[model samples]
Target: MRVGPVGVLVRPRAGVAGLVVAVALLGVAGVAVFSGSLDIAPARVLAALAGDGTRVETLVVVDRRLARTLAAVLVGFALGCAGALTQSITRNPIASPDILGVTTGAGFFAVLLITHPALLPGGSAMLAAAAITGGLVTTGGILALSWRAGFDGLRLILVGISVNAIGMAGVSWLLLRTDIDQAAVAMRWLTGSLSGARMPDVLLLAPFVLAAGLACAYLARDLAALRLGRSVAPALGTAPGRTEALALLVAVVLASGATAVAGPVAFAAFVAPQAAMRLFGTAGPPPLAGGLTGALLILAADLTAQRLPAELPVGVVTAVVGAPFLLYLLHRHRRRTSV
Candidate 1:
């Protein structure tokens, strides 16, 4: 597609790159399934996948590790899509689930509720619902705080930063006060590990991700219209107010559902869309490409975290990757302003 000043054909090149990324992601998933801190041969991995492996290998590869890998992919896709939606609606490059305080808020409630295991409902279903609620509530609060007769991107970012700081502080307090077992659970949630994900997490997140993804696709045309600015978009029949609200709601669902599954994964949301935009050389956030970018990043990061001797948290790994990218973005912004 010819987007903006660039008359680039997105079809031929983007398709091949996307396929390559997909294949690479599948290979990573296979690696996660077949290998752990200890490596497994490909033949044995295939046997384990085919259900012909020894009991120990089956339980180790197919049962535990694959589940975690799948969770990482799905969670990454959800958060990446959420980041795209938020950026499109806000017309801000830095908007993300973490920056908007949505994930932190969901994480706060999740940590609190999970602390009292008995207080949580019997399954991941209930946990997912509670987490989604937390995300929505926080997003709603940020929206309200940022609303001063009109939405301003700078104000929104500020409010989000403050809200996130407060939520994280609350999480820290909960962690410090809780018992060792509960604290351990809280720690995983904080660091964002997919270690013990079951099918329940997948089932809970998949439907929301699919639905919201479709919703984003439907709004893509409208979102493009909004790029013309406040006056032009409304004149063109894109109700700026309603569109912004819808976009925010969709973003909230995506972020919340993902957070429900894997805790608040850091940087995937921010970095994925940015990476996708650069890859595609597109003006607007590329939802499909962004999701794929996120899936690749998270899968690679999760695998690295698992393979590391220390077993570092996946979120930490993402932060390590994203911090430099963030600095680059700031540098670019400064250069642009100077020019």
Candidate 2:
């Protein structure tokens, strides 16, 4: 559709990709709902979902499985959207909460308070606040350190990797000094399991996820402008600096929300956006598609963890997939730069 003097092209690639991802997510979630310890049959599970089954079946499917599924979706979306924001700002495929120490910093603070809850008065909620604060502060420091060179993508990634290492070291050192039970709890949380997800947990996370995602969506236009080049943003009447700063902040908040709920489930942030950008044929990652892809990734990983013979955290399954992808990305980048 176009006027006499202009032309318009409409593409629904992302819309289609998102639909496929959504369908896959539903299928995986259905399997997850039916595969837990109780082993309810599919027909009974469907009846329970429809509110026609016995009380125990209803409690098993609707109460536990459904809530856990919702939590997985929310956490995955938050991390995936956050990844898109960071990558857009830096124009770097691997720039994510995981690589930037945002998640590690949040996880460190969370585990610190977890191991020493006597130091904090507000219970798990307080720990969540600490995690978010840690990510914010960590990102602020990284920005300051990397700002010296005008937000170079390589510099940001390199500095972030260093900080991430230190944060991980801190977490390890803390775990070493703590009691076994506290360490055990922290370890499980760090592994990113949906085992403990509850309806209240989903409720606690939804608002922050929605808020940060909306902020990212609002910045999308500005982000599109920045993609032309940092210098071009000013000529186009956009403040690249401010746009980037705010985007990073919002992204950290998003990642922190997920980390608070799911313990930084590694590489969903790193993997989802790159996958979405390639699959949707976007110049950059589309936040909404990236988020939907992430939700599917986590849900499917959770489903896989459920079917495993041994009890495994969802993060374990994610890392198994993500680590290889990360290596491939690094190898590709290395080859490109070398050329």
Candidate 3:
């Protein structure tokens, strides 16, 4: 049943799951903060956070770890929201920005500029902008192709795959033509490391996530109805075409902004919403739970990456988990279709 004056949804299960995931994120952040050479007492960590502790504690808590933690949280939040929006609109379990070639699109242009710096005269932030531009461009092309293919949900995914292949081919071309050193640098970014995340990156990415997230919230009611089917959504007072348009736009913006900051970190967009769907037991991807799950996944992966002996890129860790998940989903779909 709905609650109170505004008639807000009262999903106890989802609310509790969101709370738990959020708490887990905070706990991971805490661990990341207090995990350096200096052994600041547990009780004093708060003091450091407040800028009242000794220099070492303050440096450890506020300066070093806080930025990284915020970066992961924001990037993960963006991807999660984008994925939730995508899955809801497509009404497909396996659909996501990563799966649909949005991340690949984002990464391609970023690498394009990286491999040829002479084409652009800007800093890392501009590189991030290039990635956003690439995602938008790729999305437009995919939508055009999907329209030609009858605007089917599965058809859109197929179109996305084709576009993604072209983008990957372009990336390969750029890498091959570049010097080994430059290609090495570009490949490192393609692998999606959070090692370079700083306060500046967090500051730049925050507003984009906030604005797009609010837009997603506004589209929630529309998406919920659209999930029933385009024909049925109209009976529920939803504009099917408009809702789909807005949802796709917001998803692209969210996913692109996150990729811009995190170097197209893979699978957070694909895996987070699926995990949240299971955790909250929702018929569809719940936005809030998905966002929380994304944040937790990224933060945990980053923490794990740091603790590892070789210090792998964050995307590498996620791909290790996500690849199998994708295969499983495909196998399940195959079985159902066969039946």
Candidate 4:
């Protein structure tokens, strides 16, 4: 399907797959909202959603679970889209915000601010601003280091890996400098928790998420062409450099906002787009499908984490699920290259 100047090739079953994934996401969200420690009945949850529930039920659903759930969904969607954009731009299957150090960079700044309040004087808004700045700086460094002749995917990935290590080390150093209680708090944030997420956090992040999403949708055709190659992209009237820069900006913003809100959520970004492509049977990342898949993944992981005897971070659950899949993907890629 051609939209405007770019062509979007959709598989026959893509729509159906998208619909199925959307329904699954809704179901998972419902389970997440209803199966918390409070254990609101599904019917009452629906009533609360519809503004027709008892005071306590309304508070549980509206004030507590709903905000957290929405935050999860928005963050997941942003990360998924960011992942898809990064993978497509780099033409690297393993490329994601987390792996590329964007999340780590953002997390580093946010943690720094949390541990040392003197850094940023403002509230959550300033913290988010710091995260965005950190992520963009990291991205800029990676691009500058890797751009010898042009943007080389292999070099970019290699540089990103190194940068991620450095960022993590910085985070570790900060954590070590803090006292036990402070370290514990920072550790939870680093591990990614949605425990006390409120409507304000969601509100803070929504604009960035929505804006990035719209920009990605608009650039979908260009992204598809760019994935073909530099030569082909130019022929298709897509400026490869500009498109890549814009795409990276979108990714950095999305990732930074999500990290600011939920800390670094492990491999949600890495897993979502890859899983979506397989499910949608697309040649490249399907942004919408990826977003839905991410939402479902996080919601499911959060629900599981919440239901555990001792509550675990959502990042821990996602890491547990995503690590094996990543290894499998690497093996498969190696096999294909060898062939």
Judged by lDDT, which candidate is best? 4
Query: What would the per-residue lDDT of candidate 2 be over residues 202-226, giving only the tens digit for each residue?
Result: 8888998888777866787788889
**C-alpha TM-score for every candidate:** 0.90, 0.91, 0.92, 0.94
Candidate 3 residue-wise lDDT, 1-339, digit = tens: 555655657588877887788789989988987774467787788888887888977767776678888998989888998899888888987779987999889999999899999888998888878988999999998898889524577888899888888888999999999999999989988887887788888988899888877787788788889878989999999998888888888889888888888887878888899899888878788776688899899989988887898889899888887789878878988999999
Say what the RMSD of model 1 is.
Answer: 3.6
Give the residue spans of candidate 4 off by over 4 A. 1-10, 52-55
Q: Rate the local accuracy (lDDT) of all candidates.
A: 0.83, 0.87, 0.85, 0.88
Error of 3 at 28 (Å): 1.1
Tens-digit lDDT track of model 1 for 175-291: 888899889877887787787777667777778878887887778767878877767898888988887788888888888888888788888899998888787666767776788
Report the lDDT tens digits of candidate 4 across residue range 79-104. Answer: 88889989989898788999999999
> Which residue window of length 10 is worst by lDDT in model 2?
6-15
Error of 4 at 110 (Å): 0.7
Report the alpha-carbon TM-score of model 3 versus the true structure.
Answer: 0.92
Model 1 per-residue lDDT at 31 = 72
Candidate order (TM-score) = 4, 3, 2, 1
| Candidate 1 backbone overlaps, count | 0
Model 4 is weakest, by summed lDDT over 10 consecutive residues, at 6-15
How many steric overlaps does candidate 2 have?
0
- Higher-ranked by lDDT: 2 or 4: 4
